[model samples]
Target: MFVQNIRNICVVGAGQMGHQIGMLCALGGYETVIVDVNEDALKKADTLLQSIMEKWVTKGKISEDAKDAAFSRLQFKTDLEDAATNADLVIEAVVEKLDVKRELFAKLDKITPSHAILVSNSSTIVNSLIADVTNRADKVCNMHFFYPPLVMDCVEVVMSDKTSDETAQTTMNVCKQIGRTGVLLRKEISGFIANRILGALQREAVHLYESGIADYKDIDVICRKALNHPIGPFELMDLSGIDVGYFVMQQRYAETGDPQDKPAACIEEKVKAGHLGRKTGKGFYDYAKEGVKN
Candidate 1:
């Protein structure tokens, strides 16, 4: 089915990405449902969305009427089956675990309509691994969004060998509809395009920091000043969450079994200490006294 024909979207897992994605869909005039098993996460998503809307209003980005219209189209649900019952598209944005994603898609396969497309928002885990779990392999692929989905305009529409061409194109169209630049990856890779580049930069950044040549703060400043990067490697990790960086690296390591693919010790240590950045507060730069080092 064409993306224009899709009216209802179900975004499973109301974490940082899922909720903003649903809001984007709603803003694009689609009936969107953000679902999560955890009630607290759902509540958090609701609060976050409200803050986003208010910020947009203050910035004159979205009119109050338009905000209300989008708000009307957005729905929050706890049940996957109920949220996906009549959805034309299902975007899974849970934790970045292959096994966890496989299990969810296995259940979603039975729940979603036959025509509905099932996509994953995995940062590194390719859809091919999770697509096999579902009966609709032809309709499944990866639709990865960057950190802070609401602000990031770029999205990756990735296709595996089993994915149909129509599915990939339709997903790309859906990205445009939601005001995102959809970069199509005809071939499936672990991190697709953006994250692969990001991973390479991060790997070297960690190597530079861990080698004791420079502190993380100096490294961040040098990158921003030299490379013209909007955010430094360490700051981006903090913004995206140290735990998320660790998991993505861990997943890539699991897939490639490469020593360099393993997450840096600093990332692992930060995650273990519950310093998950902005969410829990401290990461590379302390956010205890000042929140969100922007």
Candidate 2:
């Protein structure tokens, strides 16, 4: 279905990306329902949405009336079936795991209406594999949005072999309606475009850190000033969360079999210790102190 035809959109997952994505859709005037199995995660998503909207209001980027309208457009649910049953589109934004995502897709396929579009917001997983669980593969595709979906305009519209041209076109129209720039990829790839660039940088940064050439923060400074990049690799990595980075990189490395794709040994160690960046208050760098910690 096209944007004008689309009414209720169900977003599965209430984590960081999921919440932001749902908020963006609601702001665009879609009836949005964000679902998560975890009650705490659902509550957190609601709180995060409020915080983001409040920040925009404070910056005069959005009016109080706009914020009220956006909030009214959004809803939250803990049940999967309730969210998917009547949705015009169901977008899965849950954790990045093959089996977990596959299972959810299978469940959503069973519960969602036959015409409902099923999409994934995966950064590195193969779009085709994610479409495998559903019988309506023609309506299954990738709608990869960048970090902070509200601020970012670019969204990668990925089409797998089973993805229908109609579905792809409709998704593009939906992106336009939401005020996002949509780029099409004909085939499924591990990291798509943006993540592929990020993957390359991640591999090199890990290699640099592992080789004892420089500390994490030192490397971050060089990238920021010398390259005029907005955020240094190490600092960005920490903010992205070490566990999430390690998860994506490990899968990409395994898929590509590229030695450069492998994360540094320190990453595994840190993740094992639960130092998962800003959320944990510690990662490659200590967010609390605003610097790297060995």
Candidate 3:
């Protein structure tokens, strides 16, 4: 019933997660509008999404006709008000800054219809922090999707104390409709589930690298070859953007004032240099070369 109510979906921020997530919703038969403040970002998202859909079609993951239908259902815009005014569900996939999200949520509350459910794609910060800025806290929740939403199957559906059951169930239903698995978290927690575990592993990996025990490349090789993990921590970081992890650490440290939660020196260096992983073409490993090695 809740799922049936969501027909027009608006995805805010056209960045790494937003574009692909909008594609998922469109593919799920929802009328999806992906909005971004920057025109260039929206243009880039359009090109990238087309390339992704083409790859999917070539790989037999989706048919060419299905791709055309998904694109037909998807639209891109630079104006938030125009994109979200009639939306039944709005997914905020902007930067990981708390103040930025709080401001956006407040604006969305005013722009969207009363029944619209607003969900954040934040990987670390819980929706509880952002929900308070809006009048309809009950309608705000976290729908955290992994990097490259088109590929990742799992989404963390986290609810704040004020979130209604209908909102959560509706989000989960949307996940199923988009062909992704949604794990519901009854309560809000920083980093949700996957990131909490991944954070711990990343912290240790950074520690091992900083401690001069081994090179980051060597550590990645060991994790992949020995532990049988598909991708190592460092490689995953590179793929997901080093600045993203840095921002998450900064947010965590600000929340807890934990010295341990501060961004590692290596991450800080990379972020400062603007080498923010796959998007920027240089991160833990340089992707400019033939093999994408450091």
Candidate 4:
């Protein structure tokens, strides 16, 4: 089926990532269902969407009518099967765990229409592992989105060895239709494109910090001023959450067995202490208030 023909899209998760993605789809004129297993999560998505709409209105980015139209295009649900029953594409954005993803796909495969495409927003897990739980392996692939999916234009499109050409084509087409910059991956890799490259830089940054070669603010300045990157590796890690960084590095380590994949002691220690970056107000730098604290 043509990507533009996919009118009904189901986003399976209502967390920060999933909510943003579903809102983007709704704004782009697709019939989007934002589903979560927990009713509270669905409620939270609704609240978040409302806040976003309000912000857009206040900023004069979109009219009240447009906000209403987008909200009307979205449906929030707690039942996965109900949300995906007639969906043309279902994007899973749940917790990043192989077992959880496998089990979700296993059930989703049975519930969704045979022709519906199944995709994941996973950053590390291989498409092969997730597809193993589903019968429609050909239609299963990774459609990874960075944090705050609505704002990020880049999407890593990953297809496993078993992924069919038709599936890849459709996914790429869908991404284009949604106004996203899509990079196709011919085969599975540890962290895909952006994260893999970013991870390498992060490993070195951690080494620099741990070895007292540079402090947090100085390193951040060098990266922003010299590298011209939007944010330094350490700063970005904090915003993305330290636990997420640890998980991605752990997955990379398991896949490639490379030394770079091994996260720094600081990362492991922060995660163990539940100091998961901005989300928790502490990681490499303190977010206790304003200003960066090392």
Per-model TM-score versus the true fold: 0.98, 0.95, 0.97, 0.93
Q: What's the lDDT for residue 115 in model 3?
A: 91
Off by over 4 Å in 1: 292-294
Q: Which residue segments of model 4 deviate by more than 4 Å?
A: 290-294
* Residue 258 error, candidate 1, Å: 0.5
Each model's C-alpha lDDT? 0.91, 0.85, 0.93, 0.86
| lDDT of candidate 2 over 100-189, digit per residue (tens) | 889999998899889999999988887788787789999999999887788889999999988999889888888887789999998888
Residue-level error in angstroms, candidate 2, position 261:
3.2
Q: Between prediction 2 and prediction 3, which has the larger TM-score?
A: 3
| Candidate 4 vs. true structure, TM-score | 0.93
Model 4, 93-137: lDDT tens digits are: 887767788999999999999999999999888789789888999
TM-score, structure 3 vs. true: 0.97
Global lDDT of model 2: 0.85
**Candidate 3, 1-294: lDDT as tens digits:** 389999999999998899989999999999999999999999989999998889899999999999999999999999999999999999999999999999999999999999999999999999999999898989999999987898899999999899999999999999999999999999878888999999999999999999999999999999999999899999999988898899999999999998989999999999999988877888888788654421
Q: Model 1, range 84-177, lDDT digits (tens) per residue?
A: 9999999999998888999999999998889999999999898899998888899999999987889899999999999999999999999999
Q: Which candidate gets the maximum lDDT versus the true structure?
A: 3
**Candidate number that wins on TM-score, 1 or 2:** 1
**lDDT comparison, 1 vs 4, better candidate:** 1
Residue 212 of model 2 has an lDDT of 90
Among all windows of ten consecutive residues in candidate 3, which has the lowest summed lDDT?
285-294
**Which consecutive 10 residues in model 4 have the weakest lDDT in total?**
285-294
Ranking by lDDT: 3, 1, 4, 2
> Clashes in each model (backbone N, CA, C under 3 Å)?
0, 0, 0, 0
